[model samples]
Target: MAQAMLLSLRRISRSFGGIQALDNVSLDIAKGDVIGLVGDNGAGKSTLIKVLAGAHDPTSGDVILEGRPQKLSPPAEAQRLGIETVYQDLSLIGTFTAAENFFLGREIAIGRGPALLRWIRRKSMGDTAMRGLEELNIDIPGIRSKPVDRMSGGQRQLVAIARGAFWGHKLLLLDEPTAALGVRESREVLDLIKRLGAQGLTIVMVTHNLDHLWQVCNRVVVMRRGRKAADLASSATNMEDVVAYITGAKEPMTPRPATTEAGA
Candidate 1:
């Protein structure tokens, strides 16, 4: 049986003034698949992610979700569709606790009407956040009381991932999640990603770490100079081939087996 397509970028293109950031790029991402997006500095990897994230509207293209056309021009629209992004900044308020950061802007209101009468349901939010962490089998000590800035980098990243997992129903976009971590911390984050994948979370992770991609990604997409250079199955390609694609040393060939949906 064919795996269902979760998201598709159809002939997407983005331009700023005369410079093209993305040039008619297209990609099909299947449900429950982990995709590693790789590229050099000038590549459109970040631009592509922002397009999907609703941070940047594509100059020309369509975003298809589950066979339906979706206009993801605004960030709110993406959130309404259960798509969430965890940027490199972690986006957590340093002064806030893990639970507080988990429910950041979208707080749970207890009352139905006016702002004066409606109160923030802090306890409810904390309980729900705790439950979510527990469900993901993630352990973060002092999540309810300790501030996020006081936590380790790995712990903070995990909190961010947990928040995304809790709210994101369809897709999770992670940008350089393990970039600032130590060796052990990086492994921990990678393991958490693998666990999420196992539980059927569709993830698009942007990373320069080829070894990390080999460990968690089912498919790797390489981009260069505003275009998609190659897409290859992790099991069928190596770091050298991926590097070659990024550096434009070799042309992209048809992906072997095309997609990883069957094994995804």
Candidate 2:
């Protein structure tokens, strides 16, 4: 049976001055989907992600989330709606511990007669962070106290993802999650992503690494020149076919063995 639809992009389009970054692209993301967004530079992958993250508004189109239309702008609105984005930069404070970074903006406070007089709950935050990581089966030693800068690249990425997973209840968007990690670290990060999916966290990932995408994503969405070129089931298509779509060597057609009720 097909999964229930989580989000629908209705003829989404975006333009930068005269340049069209996205042209009437429509997509449906189902619950528990791990969609891999792939394309070359200038393919509008980043712009599309920003649109979903509420960082950029479509020039014309609608975003429907769980059957209700939304105007996702200025980012905070998206966060409130349970959509979290982890960008390529990771956005962790190098000097702060993992627990601190996990609750950077949304910290727990106690005895708050006034906002300024309230005290932050350090131990509670650390214990909660540790529990969340353990639930994801992520074994990062000293994650509660170690500074993100002191950890390895892969561990840092995992920490950022864990933070997103903790807060984002509906959707998690990741941009080039394993971009600069070593082989071992990349493997660890991929394993964590798989674990998140197994726990029913819907995810959309943007990455240049096709191998990594195949490992974690159940579906692939290919973009070319600011438009969706192809959307296919990862198990039904090969890397060569996906590359062909990305390079414009193959035209967009109805995907075989459609993975979603909306049909690719």
Candidate 3:
């Protein structure tokens, strides 16, 4: 049986002055889907993801989530609607502990009367962050106290991902998640991605790594020069085919017309 659709991008397009970043791209995301968005540097992959992340508003098109049109803009709106984006930079404060970074803006506070009089509930926040990590089977020793800068690259990436997973109830957008990690670290991050997908989070990952994509993504969407070139099942397509789509060496396949008998 087909999974129900979770989100849809209807003829999405984005432009920067005269340059078109995305042109009439449409895509459907099902519940619990791990979609890999791949393309060359100027292929509009980042633009499309930014549109979805609400970092960039589409010049045209609608973002439909759970059958309703969404006005995802200025980042916060998208966050409120359960869409979280983890950029390649990881976006963690180097001086802050994992728990502190986890609840950066949405800090837990204790006290009643006025906001200024309230004290930040550090213990509760740390405990909650630890629990969230544990639930995801992420083992980060001293995550509540260790500064993100002191941690390894993979650990910091995991922390960023964990924060996104904890807050994003609907969709998780990852941009080059393993772009800057060692082999083992990349493997760990990929494993975590699989776990997140298995737990029913719809994921849209923008990556150039076909190996990682094959391991974790169910669907692959390729873009070329600001337009969607192909969308294929990762299990069904090979790396060569995907690379062909990415480099524009091979064109997207189209269905052939049905043929009747010669003399019918």
Candidate 4:
């Protein structure tokens, strides 16, 4: 028998001012799944991420987490529901140390009373941060306290991922994580993403890199004109199909489950 889905979006719709960003889109993401969402510039890929991450409320539709309906009014609400988003051009504090940035706005502290509260537990955060970085194979030279100002760009992005992976990341949404990275750096980031997914974190990556998608994702979700064009099993699909979808050479085809529903 098939297992219950972990997340589902129902009749989702969104718009910005007068522009229709998403048009009654819907999908499901199950546990231990990695979905690669691909589309053109204005195909609503980023907009969908923001909606799922709680950065933007959908004009309509509800996000179901753990099979329970949820209203994602803000990013904090999404995080509370174990949803994390790692976005391109929106990672790390260039001025803070890696350890500092790791616990930014979310420090791990030790205290008993309100008046007798203790100082910041640097050692605790540092230790955990070190373990996370090691797991990701992110080389930060010396200690985990090394400042981001001294670290490489790739390191910065890796740290951001490690931060999310260290906490509530049951459903991770990665938007162009390697968009501006060097070849080697991009691989490092992609490897970390895979490592996280291997740990049973359901991940959705919005990337333009077909090779990376083929390498990491179990399924692919292609969008066109703000609607889902295809949701194909990676092994059952081909480059020709994806290219055809991207260029509109092929008409959009819904997933097989949707077809079965109509027949039923």
lDDT of 1 at 97: 92
Best by lDDT: 2
Which portions of model 2 miss their true places by more than 4 Å? 111-115, 254-264
Q: Write out the backbone clash pairs for model 4.
A: none
Question: lDDT per residue, candidate 2, 1-264, as tens digits?
Answer: 456789988888999999999988888898999999999999999999999999999999899898889898879999999999998884799989999999998888887577788789999999999998888888888877788889988889999999999999899999999998989999999999999998899999999999999999999999999888898889999999999999989997653323334353
Worst 10 residues of 1 by lDDT: 255-264
Task: Report the lDDT tens digits of candidate 3 across residue range 1-264.
Answer: 255668888788899999999988888888899999999999999999898889999999888888889888989999999999999994899999999999998889987777788899999999999999999999989887889999999999999999999999999999999999999999999999999999999999999899999999999999999888888888888999999989989995432111111112
lDDT of predicted model 1: 0.89
Model 2, position 61: C-alpha lDDT score: 89
**TM-scores for candidates 1 onward, in order:** 0.94, 0.94, 0.93, 0.91
Residue-by-residue lDDT tens digits, candidate 4, 47-141: 88888889999998877777789887689888888888887866678777788788876777877556347467888878877887887677777
lDDT of each: 0.89, 0.90, 0.89, 0.81
- Give lDDT: candidate 2, residue 142: 83
Residue pairs of candidate 1 with colliding backbone atoms: none
Clashing pairs in 3: none
